[model samples]
Target: MNIPFYKMHGIGNDFVVIDNSVNSISLNKRRVKALCDRRYGIGCDQLIVLSNPKNDLADVYVQFFNGNGDEAGACGNGSRCVIAWLYRKYHRTEFILQTNAGLLPAQVIDSQMVKVNMGQPRTKWRDIPLKHEADTLYLPLAGEPSAVSIGNPHVTFFVEDLSTVDPVFCGKVLEKDPLFVEGANISFVQMLDRQAMRVRVWERGSGLTLACGSGACASVVNAVRRGLADRHCQVKMDGGNLIIDWDAENNEVLMTGPTSFSYQGSFDLDHYPL
Candidate 1:
């Protein structure tokens, strides 16, 4: 089967987006992983599939799969790119995006930038879905990481020096730790001040990407909960920066960042069968 796709990115976290509203494009784990292989296929950090909304309130339904072929509940940057695609199709500035995480209200801030309401952060043990109950603000683990769930789970370690923490090593260990029933996205955060911070993310299945959108939102929420950052702060990642606002008025996390389309094309699944 030949699949049409749009290659897009938010900051530097890229995705292969396929619209399935017109024609259903089914993918299995192996095929999804193969499509994300840099040498063998259309490489990207994740694959985004868009289809007609299952819920009446949403404009479209979006699903995200990491390069490793694991489906994720929420993707901050992926949602932005999806919104950008929708804007080109409908010429609309705002709409509701439905995902496993829920309905996210998205908006177009400008030509290059987009914003989305990512809902409130989930801070309880059951919400983060830890295997065992532990204080989310200060887990009884090494590095005293904080847990926050925007849609997926995240464990953030506040560090004084970003260079000292090995994201791949630490992230791998903590991601699969027994503490987190569902593997967690690990972030090493360094506070520049109350209004700004630097972050490096080891995404659950994508490894260390240039940026992780939900990781950034989790970082800000964790920082504010720990009294290390303001409600609104700037999170700088390797790809670029994102403005994350943990809105006090509505308890929603608002993320604003730039999204771009790299190209668009079709690939035959038979050519690279994994």
Candidate 2:
């Protein structure tokens, strides 16, 4: 079957967005992994499906799967890219998307930027869903990581320099740490100042990417909880900068960043074996 798709990205975290509004689309594990393969298939950090909303509260139902074919609860960057696509096609700026995490309200600021209200940060060991009960503020682990969940679980380590840390080695170790029952996206963060920070993330299923929206949001929230940064901060990643604000009053996270369309095309599902 020929499936139409849009190739887009927010910062450097790209996605293959498939519109399933008109036709029902189904993807299996092998197909998802193949589609994410850079050399053999349409490359992307995640595969997004836009379906007709089941509930009246949302404009559409957005689902995200990582390169490994695992469905993630939330994807901030992917949501922004979806907003960009919806805006381009519908000429509408605001949208309510229901994701696996929950309802996310998004806005297209302009051609280059989009903003998403990422809802509240989940702070408790049980919420982060760690294996044992402990302080989320200061997880009793190596590097003294702080745990936070912005729809997805994350463990942020405050480091002096992000470059010095081995993302692959550390990520492989910490992502499977016994403390995190569901595993976790691992991030190394450096505080530049009260309003700026540098971050690098090893996403749980996607491995390392140019950027990670949920990781950025969780990092800022963790930093703020630790009194390391202001409620609003600029998170600098390898791909680009994302403005992550932990709204003090509303207790929600607002992420603003740029998104771009690389191209648009169609893929044949028959080309790949199930």
Candidate 3:
């Protein structure tokens, strides 16, 4: 395969990106899953594929796949990596990119910081795709989780004790539950202070990672609806922190964070090597 890749990260959430625009790099689910295996492949939490826009509506289009090869609709962290990779190519600080979810605007805020406009979230029950719609904006599911759609479906549960909630256990069940046909990212959130929160997520397809951006945004939405915090807040994940803001007028949820570059390399095609 001899496919070239760049390793990038957002708040310690890293990815291996293959530029399909120039490489024609294609991997079956088995190979992509293997490439994400820490001990066998390139060792990334996920693999991001960058290709030319299918409809020519944007500069580029991104494909996000978890370590297990499930294609995720959106990935905030991977979006930063893809943008950073493009910036490095043109030596520009800002750019516009597209994804399976929607178009995203990105820029290098500082030497090592990047900001991304994730677009607005849809709180409609159908948008969140919860079976038997009943106002997902403040969805009072049986388990009492707040539902929102920011590129993907998310059900945020406010926990009294962050440690008491086992995200992996609960997330595992909720992700598969028929309520969410395509599955979803589940977040257990605990308000740390007026301005901060402790969050853990069970991401769809990927299970648990160091962090999940949409999870943070959804958490803030849930927290605000529950009157647990103000509209603007900081969400602390296992890997790091993300800034989330809710714009009522625009009906948008904005998340800010950093993306990092780790290394550049290539792999042979005949085998998926770690």
Candidate 4:
């Protein structure tokens, strides 16, 4: 079977999006990995599968898979990309997407811009699902990073200078730390001011991507909890900037950014083994 897909990106975090709403496609770990291989397939940081919604309130069900073929609970950047794709297809501005994490509400701000309500940040140790109970605000780690869950687990380390830290080294070492029962995305943040900060992320499954939406959200939440930043701030990543607003009144984190449509193509499923 030849599966058609759309290549899209939010900021610089790119994904191969497949509309499986008809339930005609079947994917497994091997196929997912092959499809995400840059050298061997339609390379992307992640692969997004859109299926018919199981929930009445949802317009579609979005499932995210990492480059390694692991299913992710949530992906903020990918979510925006999915919403943008839906908007283009259905010509609607507002949408609700169901994921493994939960229901996410999104709106198309414009042709290239989108905003997603990433739900609330989970701060408890159990929710972040650390090995045991520990202070989420300050985990017992080398950098004393703070942990938060925005549908996915993330640990943010605030540094005075981002250049001083090697995100690749730290992310690889800390992502699988015993402290995190499930691996976590590692974010190194350098605060430029109360309203802006520079961020570098080591994503859980995709490694060093250009940007990470959940990481940005988690970083700002941790920063605000530590009183280092305000509720609304700009998260500057290598790919671009994302506006994150932690609405205290609604306890929701709003992520706004721009998405790009790379191209559209199809690949033969027979080329990749199940």
lDDT of each: 0.94, 0.92, 0.82, 0.94
Q: Model 3: per-residue lDDT, tens digit, 151-230?
A: 88889887789888877888899888787867888888888987899998888877888898888888888788778888
Candidate 2 residue-wise lDDT, 64-165, digit = tens: 999989888999999999999999889999999999889999988988899999999999889899988999988998788899999999999999987799
Task: Please tell me which predicted candidate would have the highest TM-score against the true structure.
Answer: 4
Clashing pairs in 4: none
lDDT tens digits, residues 1-274, model 4? 7889999999899999998975468889889999999999999999999998999999999999999999999999999999999898899999999999899999999999999999989999999989999999999987788999999899999999899999898889988999988899999999999999999999998899999999999999999999999999999999999999999999999999999999999998889878
Worst 10 residues of 1 by lDDT: 265-274
Name the lDDT of candidate 2: 0.92
lDDT of 1 by residue, 1-274 (tens): 7778999999899999998887686678898999898988889999999999999999999999998899999999999999999999999999999999999999999988999999999999999989988999999899899999989999999999999989998888888998899999999999999999999999998999999999999999999999999999999999999999999999999999999999999988687565
lDDT of 4 at 162: 97
How would the candidate models be sorted by lDDT, starting from the highest? 4, 1, 2, 3
TM-scores for all predictions? 0.98, 0.98, 0.93, 0.99
Error of 1 at 45 (Å): 0.4
| Evaluation by lDDT, superior candidate among 2 and 3 | 2
The clash numbers for all candidates, in the given order, read 0, 0, 4, 0
Candidate achieving higher TM-score, 2 or 3: 2
